[model samples]
Target: MAPVKKHGRRRASVSASELAQMGVCERLVVFEHRYGKRRTVEQQQAIKRGRRAHARFYREGHMDWTRWWRYFIVFLIFGRWLTLCVAKWFQVRKPHHET
Candidate 1:
């Protein structure tokens, strides 16, 4: 008696992020891949503002900031939290002195 061979089905090659993006808007990923980004007037204005800010910073040696101030604040908070965590870890690992 001859044994029958079973064939496995092949799955489509698609990433989870890509699938999620597609779920949001099917044509968005396709459009991006095909023609690259199409910036809106508001986005262009924002880019121009950022460029001016950057140039001003270079000339003045101080940042004339924008919404990035929020990012800076968030970064400082995250750094503080990380420092506290590391300090706590070291304190826990350090041997206590007996009086």
Candidate 2:
């Protein structure tokens, strides 16, 4: 016969420190059973605020990169065209055989 387990199921509880730890790693509270307590209104609000803050940060960072890329592309095209114009104005050409 299989040996019976002696330990009972553990109770689920969240302390203030656990709440803080949850902010760092949500999986920390994975042991909480389905019968455990639900999140409070304040926690829900904080989660919403965090999501908004992260979205704003992401948008602002990408906006800066998009603006920089536009300037870089414009510079590349205009610089190359200006360089060719200047060279042509100076009549830079090789012998016909070099073509």
Candidate 2, pairs of clashing residues? none
Instruction: List model 2 lDDT by residue over 1-99, tens digit each.
Output: 111235753436545656686787655455343235467999889878988998999999999999999999999999999999999977976667864
Instruction: Score each candidate by Cα lDDT.
Output: 0.72, 0.73
lDDT for model 2: 0.73
Query: What TM-score fits each model?
Result: 0.30, 0.56
Residue 54, model 2: Cα distance from true site in angstroms:
0.2
Clashes of each: 0, 0
